[model samples]
Structure formats: C-alpha cells, structure tokens
Target: MAALRSREASGVPLAWLIEAVTAGFVDADVSTLLDEREERTARAALPPSFFGWLAAEARVAQAIVSDQNEGDSRVPYREVERAAARMLLEFAYRLMHDDPDRHFLDLPFRFAAPAARLGIESSLVIQAVRVTERRWVDQLLTAAGERAGDIAHSVLSASAAIYDAVVDSFVTDYVVAQAQLDGEMLATKRALIDALLKPGVRDAKGFDDLGIDLSGHHVAVVLWHPTAGIGPHLDTAARQIGMSAFANAVTVVPGDDRTLWIWLTFADDPPPAVLERVRSIPRDPGRVGVAIGPVARGVQGFRRSHLLAREYAAVAGRLPPGIAPDIADTERMSYLSLLLRDPERAEWFVATELGALATGAVSDRENRETLRLYLETGQSLADTAERLRIHRNTVVYRLKRIEQAIGRPIASRRHELYAAALLAHLLEQSES
Candidate 1:
C-alpha cells in the first residue's frame, strides 16, 4: 500500500488499472492489491488515510474521463465535486480506523490540510470542468474571425467588378441615345427645307399662312447669313420694316452655323429707302451679305428669284455684314456672264442697249409672268397664248411689247432674247 501510494503521488502511469476495469478484471481488488504491496516498501511514508483518499479521487476522475469519451453522460461541475468529497471521506475512514491516539473526526481535518497543499479546493472540480469549455469557445471564435475576413474580401471584389460593368453600360447607352437624337434633329431640318423650297409654296395662301397680306406684292427680299447672329438680327430688322403686314418671310436653317437663308416678299416695289434700312440691320461678329430677289405672285415665281439672289450674293461678295445688296445691280451682268459664252460682249450689249429697260420699264411682276408663260410654252407663241388663256393676237401684242421694252427683237436674236428673257424674268419675280 505504502509503495503504491508513493508511485501514485509521483504521477506514475495508472492506465493498467483503468484497462483492468474495462476488461472485466474482477479479481483485481484495488484496496487488497495495494495492501499486499505495502510490505515491500516503507510503510511510514504516507498515512493509510491519505493513500486511500488519493486512490478514490483517481477512480472518480477515471470514471468522468470514461463518460466524456463514451459520449453517454455529461459530467456536471457539482456532480464532480460531490464524487471528490465522497472519496475524501472514505480516505478518512481508512486512516483513522486503526488509530487509537487520534479520534476519527481529526483524521478528516488532517487529510484536508494536505489536500489544500496539493492545490485542491472545494471548488476545484467545478473549475476543471469550466477550463474545457473555455478552450472550446476560443477555438470557435478563431475560426469565425477567419471566415468573416474571407467573406468580406469576396464581397469587396464582387462590388468592384459590378461597378465597372455598370459604368461601361452607362457610357454605351449614352452614346447610342445621343446618336439617335442627332438623327431626329437632322430629319426635322430636312422636312422644314422641303416645305419651304417646294414650288408655289409662296402663293397668296402661302403668304396668308405666314401672316402676310400679299394682295399687291411685287418684289421680295432675300437675306443670307455670313456669320452667327445674322438670323436673329435679320428677324428683328424684318419685323421693324413692317414685315408682319407687307411681306411674308421664311427662314431656312442650313445646318451651317455661319449661314441662314431668308425670303421676304413685298406688296409693291419696296421704296428705294428700304435698302438702306436693310443695310442698317445689326451685323454678326463676322462679315454678312444680303441679296434681293425679284418678287412675283405666290411661291412659284419666288423660287427662281430666291435662287438668283443667292447666286448673285455669292458672285458679287460685295455686301458688307448686315448690308443689303441691290439685286438689280447683279442681275444683268451676272446672268449674262452665266448664260452666254461670250460674257464680256454680252455684258457690253446689255449695258449699251437693254440696261435701262432691264432695270426700269419692265415691271418685275409682268415680266416674270411673260417669261414664265414663254418658258412653259416652250417659246411657242400659240402655246404661250393658250396657256395664258389669251388670244394669239394678245400673245403677239405682249411679245411686241417685250421686244420694244428690251430694245431688241426676239425673232432676230433668238438665243440672246431667250437668255435675256429668262434672266429678266428671274430678276423681275425676285424684285416683285
């Protein structure tokens, strides 16, 4: 017993005893076996009570360890403490049972003193149970922290990828939408031009539609943009010049910021003073030019005049920004230069013979109708008379009147007269 106690106190291996219990070694009585071994060692090394107490506590701890491994029961703190206390009481009995000098009650106190020296308290068994739980909780917290960090990293990466994709999509969509808007704007501009440039659009009804009273109109004004602000400035000037009642105007946006095309018609030959009024219109920051076109009834005659005005404006390049150029001034020379191969000789003839009449006695309105009828009839007198709903004699009279006014006979100078008639008609219609 004394030898067994020394070995147990020194923390010797006790697995054999536990194995003996597990293998059903019934003959291995723990107390009897230790008693037999006591004779071979120093008996006074430990009191019998202390040896018994140590052995009992070892047995209880083994049972708890076995229960935990088997997963069959939970070792509560209180139950562990109760089992340890029972073992201590058994030890006191074993030691004091043979002691005559000390009362049995004193042995328990003596054993407790030594138990405290071994760091065993009434609450120690409870603390041992809690130590296991603490270790488990620490391991769980470590794993959670690692997993949380990994999840956060994944989320951040995903968010960055999603943000980039969204931005790319937004840019693509914006470009597509802008292109669509530009296409629509272009379509609108084409529609406006078609409506304004079509033949006969400037008829009496056309004038009325534009809020003009064209009952007696005989001439028109055509303005072009040479720079920015020309359109707005011309609009203001037109209104100031009684544009609302006496004239009808249309503005065509040519998609060039530097240019605008405007057409204006007058109830009668505009006073010569109105030219200066036109000249005084505010200029753009850059150069601008204006050209007058002959005015005639409705939009039919107005188209040719407007076109001629643009042509003259381009060729002369003489009008200062905001200044109006005399259409009559460019008509004779510009037309002769364009239509005749011998421009210089033709211009000379016009200047010498027909200049006064071309610029004077041929009222823009009548001359435009005469040429229009002539052209529509393919230059045939009978056809012109029938188209004009007049007698052939009446057509002959008008042709004679045209010849006299032009100071040349149409029959003698077929090509020259035809070209002159066309140019004169264009100028007359524009001026009207």
Candidate 2:
C-alpha cells in the first residue's frame, strides 16, 4: 500500500503528496490536464467527443456496487449509484491533481459511508474501492488514446497514488462507520430478543429481517463462568454441541457477565445429555456453570425452555456443593422445581393449603409421608406399608389423618397437590 503511494515520476513531488494529505484536499480539474497533455502529445484524450460520452455514459459506474452487493436485501441502488458516479468523477479529478483527499466533502469521495449503510462489510468495501479504482483507471486509459502515450507514465503513477490513498481512507472510514452501525444493530437485536422472550410478542416479518426464528423445537442451555471471558468459550461449546448432537444452535448473551443463553434447534426433541458434548470440549476446565432445559416446540417452547434453563440455575444454587449437576432435566424435577422456584411463596402456599400437615409435627410428617408414598405407589396399601415398614392399617390411618389435615378427601384430583407438597419436603430433605 505504501509502495503504491510512493510511486511518483518527474514533475510530481513526493513532499507535495504528504503536504496535500496533511493540509486536507482540493478537487482537481482533470479535463484541463488532459487538454494540456493533448497539446504536448498532439493527442485528443479529452476531446469534445469523449466529454460528450462521459456526460451520458458515466451512469454505468453506478451499477458496479450493485454487482458487488450479493444476497443483501437492503441494497440501496439509488444511493449506491449516486455515490459511484461521484466516486468515478473523484477518481478522474485525483488522476489530475494527485490529491488523494481531494473532493473531501463530496458524496463520490465519501464512498465508505454509503457502502457501510448499504450492508457492505468493511473488508469487502475496501476491496470494492481497490477494484473500482483499477476499473476506472482502465476506462481512463482506453479513453486516452495512444497519441497521449507521452504522459501515460505520469498519469498511471498519479492514479496509483490516488488509488492507494482512496483505498486507505475508504477502509478507515468504513471501519468506523461499520462499528457505529454494528453498535446500533446490537442494541436493536437486544431489544428484539427481550421482546421475543414473551409469549405472542413475535412478528414473523421482524424476525425474518433479523434472521431469528422461534418456530422450532428448542433446547436451551444456560452457562456462566465465574472468571474469564465467556463468549469464545460459549461459542466453542455451541459449535461442539451442534456438531456432535447434530442440531443447529443459536446463542444469546442476555446481558449477563460471562453468561451465555444457548438454544439448540432440532426437528424433534433433542438428544438426551446433549450438553455433555459441550462439557467435553478440550478447553473445558470444569470451572464453567451449566444448566439445561428440556426440549420443547415452537415459540412458547423456546421461551419456556429458556425460563426453565434459568430456573434450573436457580435450583442448582440452592443445591449442595460437589454435586453441581451437568444437566437440569426440568422434566424430572418439574413438580418440585415449581416449589423450589420460589421457596417462600411455596412455603406460604403449603402452610395455608395444607394447614396442620404443613407444620413439622411428627405425626403430621408421618401421615404426610405415608400419604405421599401411598399415592406414589399407585394407592397400593401393601406397597405403601412395605415402603413405610408398617401394616396396611397404618397406611389407612395415615390417609385419614392426611384427608383431615388437608380438609379434603384424598382422590385423584388431589394427587397433584400432595405430589407438589412431597416434592417440597424432599427438596428440604436434601439440605440435611
């Protein structure tokens, strides 16, 4: 890049190039130079005929960027054309003046802003500047006939310097513009994600624009590291899990430090223990926290899975050390998880709903335990008694006491209630 800018022939001073760059730029009149060069070489490079052609044919340059903007739905053809025309004219002027930063306030010279706005990546825009400049040089050379050969070397040198300088400026501006757009886009995506977390908050057109789809089966995983950056690690984990488990995955940061919310999408329920693949990555130091939600379908399922994944993290926090489970099969402890989700609220509900049995009385505990066992054993007195190591009459007596304590006859409808209560008790037991 520096070599291109350093190329200067006789009559063109290198110091002037640096000075021109330092002092800003002035638009160069190229047709006037062509007229002078033509006087020396007795050529007609800037003939009346060529000027007439440029008046009409310069519009062709506008289509160049459109060809480069592949698969971009937001291609702004009119703005791109306006910018390209200006860029071509800017190139023509730079060829004469040797001022790289000439036409500073013009739309043609400000190519990078339009490129970035039209969904062009910075790297690609830099390449576009290089390619477009070379093409412009080619057209200029063809336009300037062989009779102008005396000054062709000088013209090429000036063009190369212009090309290098224009490319450098375009690249710098493109990167800065891209960063600003990317920041704005990131904030927009974050807002959309927050909105998408709610039920019935999706817009198909909006999601399509952002390329986010929740209308699929999703298994969500929550991961966090106490120390170290997490995006790269989570990215590695997502890739590993997706490849090994044969599912496509999307990740969301959810604005937590070193935490990642990953959702793996599948045609059906995801494979069992899918996160084990994430845990198996070579970088796995076992320092990262992981919790997984069960597979479910559609938008509701996607939101529910994330909610459950977060809920699993909550449950894990309350669990004892050295037993930080890898998977949080929300399906397994779902009944209990409902209680564990908010211990205080569950406790209040239990106390109010279960009355005396919710108190920790020995006989009440015995009756509640026997009733939980009886229901779990399919109302089998023998099975409940054997599990409790007491006679069938003892099971019957406990059932009567449970019915009285709860102020309701023990029936199929009451099973869900008692099961939730039993799960709460069992979760409490883990604390001991």
Candidate 3:
C-alpha cells in the first residue's frame, strides 16, 4: 500500500526506492512501511532530476539519512538547502557566461535558506537564479527604456551642489582681485587731481570732468595730511550732512603724508552755521590747518581759490592741537591778501616786493631770518637788533638795504607794504 501511494504522488516509479533502503535500517517492530506516502509527498515537491544531480555531486561514498536504528545520520534540512542554492547559483553563472560589463552573481542569496530548509531546495535554487537573471535584464532595460523622472531629479541635485561651490569660489577670488585693483585705481585718480589742481599744472577742462560746474558756485579749498585719517573722516562726515548742503563738492586729492586738498562750492555765501559745521569735525593729532579761498569760477577760478585758502591757513595763528585751522583765523596777516589770487603770483610777488634784497648780493636765507626777527620784534629797530645779537646801527643799515631792495620807503608804507613783504617771507620760509 505504501509503495502504491509513493508511485501515485511522485509519478516516479523509484519513489519507493528510498523507502526500501530505509527499511533495512529499521526493525519490523520499530517501522512497518513507515509513512511511504509522506516520503512521496516530500520527493514530489523536489525537481525530478534533483536527487540524481545531488547523488552525482556528493563526494562521500555512502548515502546519509536520518535513521537511528541503522546508524545512518541526517544533516539538518538547512544545510542541504544552502548547498543546493549555491549549486544552482553556480550553474546560472555558467549559463550566462562571464562578461566584463555584466554581473551574474549579484543578488543576496541568504533569503533562500528557509525555503531550502523546507526540503524544497531545488525550487529555491532555481528561483534565486531566475531572480538574478531578472535583475540584469531590468538594468539593461532601464538604460534603453523611457527616462525615469527620479533620475533627472538626482542629477539636478548633484549639479546644483557643484555649481554652488564653483560660483562661491569664483566670487571670493573676484572680490580679492577687485580690492587690489580698486586701491590702484584710487591712487591713480588722486595723482591726476593733484596735478591738475596744483599751484601750477597747465589748466584745462579737468574740473568739468570732475563734475563741477564752476559757473554758478563759490569755491573753497581745504588742505590736510593724507595719512592723518582726517581726509577720510571728513569725507564720511560731510557725506552724512545731506547732499543738498554740498551738491557739487569735490574732495581733495591726497598728497603725501603731509597734505591733502578739497574743493567745495556753496550755492550762496556759506553761512556761519555751515562753516562751523565743517569746522566741528575732529582733526588729527597735529595742528590741523585749513585754507578757504575766495569764490572763483571754472578751472582757473578754482585754482585761484585753492591758493587763497592755502595762504589764509598758513598765516593763521598757531592752530590748537587736533583743531583744523581756518581762513577766518588769519585776519591779522594782511600780507596774505596779495597771494589771495594765486600762490604762484605770491611767489612772484616775493621776488618783486623784496627787489634788490632778493638779488644775489644778499643771501636770501640771511635776509629772511632778519625779516622774521624784525616782524617778531614788532619792527622795532632796537628790539630787532637785540634779537639778532647785532648792534642797533647794523640793524639800521640792513633795514635801509631792505627798504632799497623793496623799492619802497619803510617809514611811509611801513603799515601796508611792509606787512605784505613780511607775509610773503613767512610763506616762503614755511614752504621751504
């Protein structure tokens, strides 16, 4: 009856062969055709050729089974399953043939372990092989198939990150280079302004280029040390004062460590309030001097205004430390009026005003010192002599020579001409 069932279930005439082999291991009392139908059930589930293949592959001489009476041993079902899965995977690799671009053994095989343990080893192995083949086919199909929206999204995200990094680097480099280039450009512009606005640089429409309309404005000049921090501070402060008050103003071209200049135009006669506002800005540690020129128009007019401002500032009283000197402070220096039009003209005036005294006969250095002492002493003959440590008679003789060279009577024009000559001499010394 067991043999009949095995034949019916397995459709293999040999399904009862394993039963016969197991019968020899069990005594009649222990086993009587034990569950042949069950045995057929398990074998029917396996591939038809699986047992044969296993028999051919097994290296051991004797068959192993789970039968205590016969001393035959059974391996765990899991072990058999693992072996079968591995074998089938190997077979698939051979079938596909090795190709550099293809991956035949990629999928994880551990999942087939349970199926093998259920005595369905051949089916699990074959299924695993089919799974690996399907994966390869899917990969190829994706390449040749319709575009996946997700792929484009992933590519765009990566590209965006790369682009951001590249742009950030480029901007950083550009800023550094721009900073250096800007400094150089500023220096060049300052030099050009200095030359064109100087006491003597051939004048042209340069002021027009600077955005100044000389026709309708009163110009004033301010000079300071470029390195003193006063220039930038003044600029910042002035800019904060609202544009209406200084619509067409021009900052001075920075000179060396000691000098800088600015030109300002007021629509109306600058009120005391405006002047005071400008004067109020803190100055550098030294005596901060400023010059205000009479209002002038055009480039030539601006040049004149610059000179006058400089003259006024120079003759002004000893400026308080950190306080800018202004033109109003120098009202006492009457001689500065001569140079109020042009510094170059003042220079010429010095040569002419001192005439013979300016000649090669008298050392200009000695004469200038004598004049300074004379002025300091309030032009008193006795006091002038005392300061120079010379006899009064000698002072008298020098004064006469001075009067001769100047082509004027010291006693008559003493108040006017002497004052002019004295201021010119002072300016010459200060400049030197």
lDDT of each: 0.44, 0.60, 0.46
lDDT of 3 by residue, 199-317 (tens): 66545555444554555454554555423555565555444332434535655455445455666765556666665555555554244555556656656666777766666555453
Error of 1 at 403 (Å): 30
Q: Which segments of candidate 1 are over 4 A away from where they belong?
A: 1-196, 199-257, 267-269, 279-286, 318-432
lDDT of 2 by residue, 1-432 (tens): 343245444344332222222222233333432235323332222222323333333345445555666545565555444445445444444554556555532333455766786766666655655676676556555544552475456556756766666576677788888889878876777776677787775434455534545676888877766466566776676566557666765655544766677777776665566655744655454555667787778777878888888887767655645444554556544655776667677777767666778766788777767877777887899999999999999788878878887778778346665755675465556656
Q: Candidate 2, clashing residue pairs?
A: 86-108, 87-108
1 against 2, candidate with superior TM-score: 2
**Cα deviation of 152 in candidate 2 (Å)?**
5.5
Pairs in clash, predicted candidate 3: 252-261, 252-262, 292-309
lDDT of candidate 1 over 330-422, digit per residue (tens): 443355326443445544544444444455553533554565577556778788877778787877777776677666765566555556555
Give candidate 2 misplaced runs (Cα > 4 Å).
1-57, 67-74, 85-128, 139-153, 176-186, 199-215, 228-231, 242-245, 248-253, 273-279, 285-287, 317-321, 327-432
Model 1 superposed RMSD (Cα):
35.7
CA RMSD of all predictions: 35.7, 10.2, 29.2
lDDT of 1 at 86: 32
CA lDDT, candidate 1, residue 178: 51
Better of 2 and 3 by lDDT: 2
| TM-score-superior candidate, 2 or 3 | 2
Instruction: Give each model's clash number.
Output: 20, 2, 3
